[model samples]
Target: MSDICVIIAAYNAEATIAQAVTSALAEAEVAEVVVVDDASSDATAEAALAASDGSGRLIVERQAQNGGPSAARNRAVALSQAPRIAILDADDFFLPGRFARLDPDLDLAADNIVFVTPEHAARLDPTNLPAAPREVEMLDAERFALGNLAQGVHRGELGFLKPVMSRAFLTRHGLRYDERMWLGEDFDLYMRMLLLGARFGLTRAVGYAAVQRGASLSGRHRTADLAALEACCRAHLEMPASPATQEAMRRHLRQVQAKLLLRQFLDRKAEAGLGAALGFALAPPARFLPIAKGVARDKIAALRPPAPPRAERFLLPV
Candidate 1:
């Protein structure tokens, strides 16, 4: 068994799966690499097999039916016997000598390493806007939590927790991606792991290259995706949390979901017409007033500073 098992979930990724698998195999700490093909219409499995060069170290499993990436991931993880597991999208690649940079003693450390793209670039948004990469040092649990909150508030990005995790820690906490969620399943898993008291470690080295293509998962948007995100937020609120922490999480979720909804509304407005988009957008909010109120109230409450003028209530136009 390898010290680490790298799992890649592929669907119609023939053009990129080979490079991704090769990168995983090149990882010094990765003893085994598994590729799960989710009934791809393309020759993704064939490409992965060819990349493995008949090496038994690489295993490919083709699902009989079409399952989502989360299901593929769960299947891959179940087949692996490694103590550590890292997931890379089929289009993404790992940096050279990346696994060598990971500390062997990391046991749920809260210091997730900074991610650098394949071009040695950093992105501030999921859209892959270029930015300078900063080295993140080790941080205590509370500090890391605060960092997550800060990032969520300022950058609209959640910085705590990641998909790459210790298998032992995952099993211990029964952490798994929500297969039902078509989008934001990773976020849900990450947040739950954090709530479960998982530790993290940070490395300045960029271990993985996240492929930023127009067709990538994060690039696509749909009404189902929006619904999934809202459901995730509701689930987070249902999780056991202190009043302050719950309020912060709820605020972050609402803002993020609102942003997504607004984006979709604008997109539809651009394509069809503003009238149609407004009707579409307003329908959900109208039917879900109580839910929207809870989210909006939490968001507004969290924005207030230690002391503020009473008139500051009007500052939030949400």
Candidate 2:
């Protein structure tokens, strides 16, 4: 079987599909590249086909109907023949030596690799990037709970949103993307995989280039999306938390909820404002207080400046 199968989900990504496919094909370890077009109305399929030309390894599939990305990805993974599978959005491209950089242990076994992008790249900025240097390591149940809890709290930074996974592990755990969740599906799947005792490999290398654009799913904010994130948080919390982990989970959930609330309040859209307010009002009273406190702390943190030397601080006191 092929060492790795790269799956790309496309929907009106004509502008970048070729580059993405070409990059995937460039990876020496990637045995095949599969592009699933979710019934795009644009020339995405055509572009993918053109990119695949002369590369007999490229397989282009089209959905009969316009399903969302999660569904499209599921369809592509089901058809993938490789032992390991890497997922990339149509608008994203992998850097050279991506597969070569992955942990050899993971490369040979049924493990997952979490590849992180560079710091200044607009697509996946380092400030919001997850822990890096894709190395495989075992995780205990408690560790998994805490790790996922921390990830939920810092979802924007953990960047566990999406990563390369082993098809064998997925099959063993029956792990698949939730077709119902359009937003944060990657988070959901990753959390579930962790709960299933999947090992992790972290890499600082920017193997993938994620294009930041207005039409991206993450670019759009909706009440349903926040609700989905909250639901994902709740799911992670229910995964048998230890006492310490439980407290951590609660704190993380409160912070996440508060951030969502703030986002809702600041949203210019009237409907989103109403929804955010309603969501905040419906949250548990105990949690609301913590959420508010967390919000205030975050605001203060944002306002604070960097620390200076003691002597300099006295000499140039602000």
Superposed on all Cα atoms, the candidates' RMSDs to the truth, in angstroms, are: 9.9, 8.1
Candidate 1 local lDDT, 95-205, one digit each (tens): 565666566566542222233333443222323322323343453433433444423231224442333578888898777777877666666676676666665566433
Residue-level lDDT of model 2, residues 84-181, one tens digit each, is 88887887677666667665445122122222222223243334433344554454334434454443121333333345688888888788888877
lDDT of 2 at 251: 64
Per-candidate TM-scores read: 0.71, 0.71
| Clashes per candidate, residues 3 or more apart or on different chains | 10, 6
275, model 1: CA deviation in Å?
A: 5.8
